[model samples]
Target: MAKAVQKIKLSPSRDIPLNKLVLSQKNVRRIKAGISIEDLAEDIAHREKLLQSLYVLPILDPEGQETGMFEVPAGGRRYRALELLVKQKRLAKTAPVPCIIGDMGTEITAEEDSLAENVHRVALHPLDQFRAFQTLREQGRSEEDIAAIFFVSVNVVKQRLRLAAVSPKLLDVYAEDGMSLEQLMTFSVTGDHARQEQVWENVNKSGYDEPYQIRRVLTESTVNASDKRVRLVGLAAYEAAGGNVLHDLFEEDGGGWLQDVALLERLVAEKLRTEAEEIAAEGWKWIEVGASFPYGHDHGLRRLEGVLVDLTSEEQASLDALQAEYDALQAKFEDADELPDDVDVRFGELEEALAVFENRPDIFKPAEVSGAGVFVSIDSEGRLSVDRGYVRPEDEAPAAAFDVERGTDTSSTEGQEAGASVQRAAISVGGASTEPEEDDEDPARPLPDRLIIELTAHRTLALRNALGENPAIAFQAVLHNLVLTAFYRFTSSGSCLEIGLRTPTFPAQAPGLRESVSAKAVEARHESWKARLPKSENDLWDALTALDGGAQASLFAHCASFAVNAVYEPANRYNQGRVSAHGVRTRLDQANVLARAAGLDMVQAGWRPTVDNYLGRVTKPRILEAVREAKGESSAQLIDHLKKADMAKEAERLLDGSGWLPEPLRLADSSPSSAEPEGEAGPLPEFLAGEEDSANGSDEHPQQLDAAE
Candidate 1:
């Protein structure tokens, strides 16, 4: 302020006739890029005026005198647009165009002025543009209006508005370039600024701060719409109960997350209870209700066999018509590349119609229903699974011995009650009621346990000696034991030899595991053998003896197949004292041996990496890794910018037929994999080599992530 500053003269702006303006050759832009001049002309014609002023300089004569015409050095595009308008007669030839005439006396050259004008300009920040959209929205402009004005889709407008509506603090951080756009995009899932900032603070320095991880943390408390509970209670029902759902506009969220988990749980329980009551009305002694039951829930319970009920004539006709219509549609569009919307809808309707007949319940006898109970639960696909006719061990009737004299067994309900009087009159010597009637004092006393054991021990030694001599009988005995463990685990061993086989049923399995190709083949093979075999277990020896060597071997193989326990369970790996890690590893090693023997190939087994099964459940980096491995780095790059869900889906499509298998599903190499500890993750890919150190850095704490987990 001590010294006065001198002011410099600035360039003057004035209106120049369209005809008076000439294109400058000194303009730096030559190649056609971005918007075309034709489009710009149309835009100018639509607006009826130019929004930006052109930079012009007077043309010099040979003697350096001013010419009436001016040349645009920086705004040549505008001059061409105006020229186009004038030629089209949309604007008069003599129309005045706004221009900022550069000082002719200045030392700067036209080219230098043009370059400065172009280089000194700054484009608006994306955050500013987003807020501008927000402002337009706040000012009562419909999203459609904003989209129309900005030449963008309404969805784009909505995405911008959503991004702008994120916490002001986060937006400020975004403005400061504190986070990437993707991280900011995921943080927009929630409106709670405090939670957003806390999450950012928790994961900012940690490599764990991926977009999907942030989204996972934000929605941790909320239940996924694809959850079994949500499927049991429809989305509309959950929303109608005053629940809020946070949806993502960015990716496929499978309908989004339900904010009210407690509400959803309560609704699921209520619906299950209602379903149970309905089933109980069908004469069940008791009913168990839940979203799902553990596999083998009826391990010790007896499953009563019931015949498939015949459909009514009306129902059968409807089913036939539906099938015929479906077939007709399929034949009609057999050569079509894609189906029409109506055809697609009708196909779904026809499928539903067909499913109704297929799912028709079998009717159990009244007596069986009175003694058995129902397990009303939801299947993996969220369909109601009413497992009727399971009789608990305690509910079973007391066993009655055969009355040799009457040639009847009194175990049946009617037999027990009706034959009571007749049997008592004759002083029955069998069954529970025949226990030592004081009148006769003639009853078969129970044999001493030790005496029986000694007698059976002798018989067992003799039988073992005989079985050792005869390979055929030994094979049949082994098959019998396997058959019991496979199909009738509830049946106690009756053979003297204790051949052990344990088939651990998986508590959780992939959806439709029972409907897989391999599963169906196994089922068909088992049923074919069962149809040829005798009904009673007591006749098993005769049935085995009746079979030829080939048939006996096939039966043995079929039964032995059920004993394969190749399933990997985390609970089994860390069984405290029951099962050590080495034990689990050794079990899997044996499974590998079996796999090699069977020439098992997972790809041929129809196990592919699908979104629902594998890809969609893993992290984005993992999906990229799979894509990189199967397709190549270039292919991975194509989907690198996509959100986690979209990336997983795209990766699945890319990995199709690539024969890629996750480590767990892959056959172990010839190397001793059993020697490696289960805790080792092995070597990561080159692209993700440093990710581990960053993800689990010693200085960084991922408390929020662990807490959410």
Candidate 2:
């Protein structure tokens, strides 16, 4: 019933002489790729034999007579390797090479056979290769040796090993293509399998898994060794305290992360205390030692003047020589495309030499040091920043008088020595109670609460300045208050002075906000006023009366600008009365009116969207919204496929110069209008619009304000 199976002829395997073999035209491999021929030849020389046999067909003349030479259809690389070995005298020309001779009577052509041989074989999976490298490493093969065998860089071998060292659970996930290689690499930053699995679970649960997020989750409790705080507490000190550090081998880690934050903080505090003790040795009345002090910590305190100590003659000579050298190097490199290495190194040396001369110590008088105190803290650069010579209000009097004013207590040795020594006070264990301290001056009541004290302090000084500068505006403000009091039934106004207010310090702000353009402008204005004002407060009125009308008006405007505060405090949501929710809303609307009158343009005020400022810190959705608002949906779509970090970066580039602003920074009057041409595209999504409205001021038309910024 069934046909008999036919026997088929097969290719025969044989050993062919190296010199008798030649590369075939139908070999198909043309462009150079993968491993180099030289490395392959070296590999063969080391092994002393080929691992795979070449597929070859015997060449013949038109007469069908054997030419005794073979043409390689497949395994051309192996043939080339042998040929290279023979040429290099590493092998004999007559050395036998392994070959599989294909029958000439076959239907398949040489080119098809070569293509099939090259393409049909399955390439090794990356994970399998990684495991193979790991096995070799375990067998005592060095990274360099492995790299040499594979014709790869040592770094590549190290990277594969690092990947192989990851948890088997994650490796299986990677094998199944559930996670990307980059994400796998991120997981490799930490060695704990539990942590790796935990982070993976968190990634799935959060559904915001990016490589950066994985890294952040893995190192959340850890502190970066390069962080200023960590730098303040040296890594050596942290390590000496038994703190552990995790290293990232696959990427630049900036010296890795310290895992013990509490230990680091303790070391930092101890070091700071030591530094504080040294500062106290200078006879300061008090030393407020802290990791960081609030901006304007010196507010309301008198700053004593100090002179810079003069540089010694030797130092002066060194500075002069370094300056000369630096100038010569700069001139020499000015015409060149880039500075030479030696010249750049010389410049660095010169800078270091010059810094010693530039940072001469400031010399304060002994009397000032006795009466004043110092703020011993760390600067942004991780260096100690000593703010000296601030005299607190209570300590303004002479030090002797200040101490004498507080009567001697019964506990003093002078008063109690004659009597049986009082029992020594018990040491307070743990820490002091967190209960609020009662006011010393008024024991029955807290001294106008801290916030009120701060607020009134700033308001009082600012009102004084405003009244001095703008007598006309001050009189009008008084009249307006009187009119409101006489005409209205109730008034809950906190203060009678309706003049502008200037806060002495911002309790909350972004990093480096003190260096912002607005902050600098205010500082410059304050300095200018301080210079012109009479030294004595008694003479302030006379000085103000002498000012011209234009000058008074200009000063009045500057003072009034400071009173604007549209900050939406949490009280508006809960505690409510000091600033009611509706009142806060109304306040913002009025503030917007003031801003429009003043022609405030935040962009021109030096606010731009940078990674540090806006882009890199927000969510991907928020970044997309920003790009959509600034560039349009199509542009937003172009980067939708990227991860959060990459999307944020790309969005920053696309939105640059598009004049986009976050809702809080956007002017109240800049809201889109209905009067534009019909069918105009690019309307913000409803969800984003709701978010913007809640964050931004009320609906005010652009035409209601000044021209667009």
For residues 1-709, write the lDDT of model 1, one tens digit per residue: 5988899877889889888988999998787766678878877876888898999999989999998988889988888888887888888988999899898787888889888877888888999999999999999999998886666789889889999988888888889988889889997777778998988877674434667667877886787787766777899999999998988778777798888877876787677766765565565666666555432356568878777789889988988899999999999999999999999999998998898888788888766766677776667566677777888877775431122234443235432322332222211111011112132122233322222222222222222223333445456556655687788765423222344444444434343333345555655665687789877789999989998987776666555454445554333444576545564465556555445545565666665676655665555766766766666666766677665655665566667677776655555774211212333323332224465643532211111100000
Return the number of clashes found in candidate 1. Answer: 0
Error of 1 at 613 (Å): 17
> Which run of 10 residues does model 2 get worst, by summed lDDT?
700-709
Candidate number with greatest TM-score = 2
- lDDT for every model? 0.65, 0.65
Cα lDDT for residue 659, candidate 2: 68
lDDT of 1: 0.65
RMSD of 2: 11.0
* Residue 709, candidate 1: alpha-carbon lDDT: 3
lDDT of candidate 2 over 386-493, digit per residue (tens): 777888788766654555456423223322321111111111111122235333233234222232222222322333333434546544544554565677625414
Residue 395 displacement (Å), model 2: 1.5
Looking at model 1, residue 446 earns an lDDT score of: 35
* Residue pair clashes in candidate 1: none
